[model samples]
Target: MAKATRWRNFTRSEAFSGYVLVSPTAIYAVLLLAAPLATIVAFSFFKDGYLTVIREFTLQNYVDTWSDPVFRAILLRSLFVSGMVTLTTVLIAFPIAYYISFNVSRSMKSRWLFLITIPFWTSYLIRVFLWKVILGYNGVINSTLDIVGLIDQPLNMLNNVQAIVVTLAHAYAPFAILPIFVALEKIDRALLEAGQDLGESRLMTFWRVTLPLAMPGVVAAVLIVFIPTIGDYVTPQLIGGGKVPMVANLIQARMLDLDNKPMGSAIAVSAMAIVTLVSLLFLFLNRRFLRVQK
Candidate 1:
């Protein structure tokens, strides 16, 4: 009884210390993320236009946003592009992650993982621009095709939807791969042995054991890749040829170009709501799958 009481006292003190340590980060998030988000919410409901001080509450901005065809189109395009990029990244990253996790020596695994990190040391804009140069009409792809006599004229590679997906996929591939690799590495060798002992073939063992165990990584990869790529405006602007605009671009144009702050805030809030809903759905599915496996 005395020991149990002492252990409880020790746990209470440790919990207090841990909270003390995390308190600064919690405060920082409030100062940065919470404050700005609250301000955006407040501004989203403001009555008048940019200059008008109509402090009265109104849903006019949201109504206008929903009615705008351009905003709706932009939102759909963002979802499509982000979905494509996320799927492609996962497909490409999966095999690489599997090989590294299951086949490579520990020493080589560390080296290759380090190589992935090397790309992050450079400017993101510079890396993206490199893709632009490679995919441009007069760029390496065109030059190669021309030299091979594949076509008479340069292909219009710039300012297109394909270019946006390709560039974003390339940019975000590491994010997908790392999570998958970590998950794959966490898998137990005993599970494979158990499957084999149960007369499962190699493919069956992988399907029944490996894939199920690594699903958390898969979900993580998808969420990480999908969420940001869908909201990205820069890649769309650079490679989407000004012809295709994602929701982010629309928000940017409304906020800065058109000087319509209320509409922009409304759009921002709506996007946040959509993202939150999607994320919750993903989490629910992940948990359901996890429970089934168990």
Candidate 2:
């Protein structure tokens, strides 16, 4: 009777429903995400032949991937561009998120969030193309500047690293903002009030109490912006004008243009490894701040 009662409780507990609820997503991840990731990792160890992947296991693909100067340059450039975009997006986003959380009335907060997400109403590819148009020679900015006599000729804005950064920062702004807003909203108002009561200035209280509490959202914002921007293909292709190729472009070139799947897989693995290490390092460095809000 006791065993039967325990079994009945177990069936209705959150642990059971949690499993039931998560099973579909877990299965989907295993089939769609893990399987392809395993395939890529497996291919990274194989050898590339003339229009064929050699089944023989070897470390030569990784060795050659690391040895290539072009790959190193492109990978470094990708990291730099992604880092700039993350910084630009987060720094700009924090203020907007704070304003919405602390200043906007509860009634108006939804409208503000709605406005923030207006950029998402359009397709991402269309947005990238729009950025291309904005920064292109004889495009909106150049045309307006010329009309106002700002320069002698149209500037070469497109096909550069800066253009890539600007396009990505704008694209990922909403992502950064939402996470940060969620974080800022979770902060207790009493904590800020207590800090001020304890003789801390508003700025100092925010520095000590507010920012630390919001660190998780900030970290989430950083990782969300950083990871995808590093692997971005469309922005580099459109905004960089195919001249400033990042890691994604190189991977595409290897996988498709050169028909070297192993080499492409190797590059992809290396990039994933680097991103993982950077993300771990960031988490480690921010462990203190993460513990604060708790």
Candidate 3:
């Protein structure tokens, strides 16, 4: 009885110490994330426009935002762009991840990994702007095609959906690759050997063993790529040439240009809700995938 009491006391002391050690991080999170979220939620209910606060509750903002055609179009366009970007980044990154984890030698793998991530060392804005120059009317792409007699005139490549997708893909590809690579790296080599020993083909082993183990990374990459692309304002504005209006742009214009703070807040809230839903769905899928593998 004495020993049991001593162990219980020791466990309680350890738990208290652990909480004390983590208290700093908890306080930071409350300040940075929780506090701001609470502010946004509170602001959503207030009757405020620009510099004036009416201190009353109203649903007119949501009503007007939902009724606006332009806002709806921007929301839809944001979804489409984020979806395409996620799909393209994942599909392209998977093969590179597969090769790195399963095929390459150790020395070559390090070199190739360095090469893949080296693009990120450059300025992000400069990289996106380079695409702008390349796709412009007098850009290198058009000049090269003309020189090769493949085209008589420059193609209309700039300020379009294609430009936005290409730019975003380049920017987000590393995120997809890194997660999948981490998942692939965690897989045991012995599992593959055992599968082969049981007469499973390479493709069969990959489908059953490799892919299942790499699912956590896949889900992580999807969330990372999709979440940011959905809210990206700069890429669409710069490359989309004012033709495509994402949800972020619409919200910004509403708040800054039109002085419609209420509608802007509504749009912001709507976008946040969509993002929250997608993130939850991704988590569910990831949990399901993990369970199936088990």
Q: Against the unseen true structure, what C-alpha lDDT does each candidate score?
A: 0.88, 0.95, 0.87
Better of 1 and 3 by lDDT: 1
User: What tens-digit string does per-residue lDDT give for candidate 3 at 219-251?
Assistant: 889999999999998888889887887998888
Per-residue alpha-carbon lDDT of candidate 2 for residues 101-215, written as tens digits (9 for 90 to 100): 9999999999999999999999999999998899988799999999999898999999999999999999999999999999999999999999999999999999889999899
> Which candidate gets the maximum lDDT versus the true structure?
2
In model 2, state the lDDT of residue 64: 96
Q: Count the backbone clashes (under 3 Å) in each candidate.
A: 1, 1, 0
Would you estimate the TM-scores of all the predictions?
0.92, 0.94, 0.88
**Rank list by TM-score:** 2, 1, 3
| TM-score of candidate 1 relative to the true fold | 0.92
Deviation of model 1 at 289, angstroms: 3.8
Better of 2 and 3 by TM-score: 2
In Å, residue 86's CA in model 3 sits off its true spot by 0.3
The prediction achieving the highest TM-score against the true structure is 2
Predicted candidate 1 versus true structure: per-residue lDDT over 210-251, tens digit per residue = 988899899999999988887887888888767888888888
Candidate 2 accuracy as lDDT = 0.95
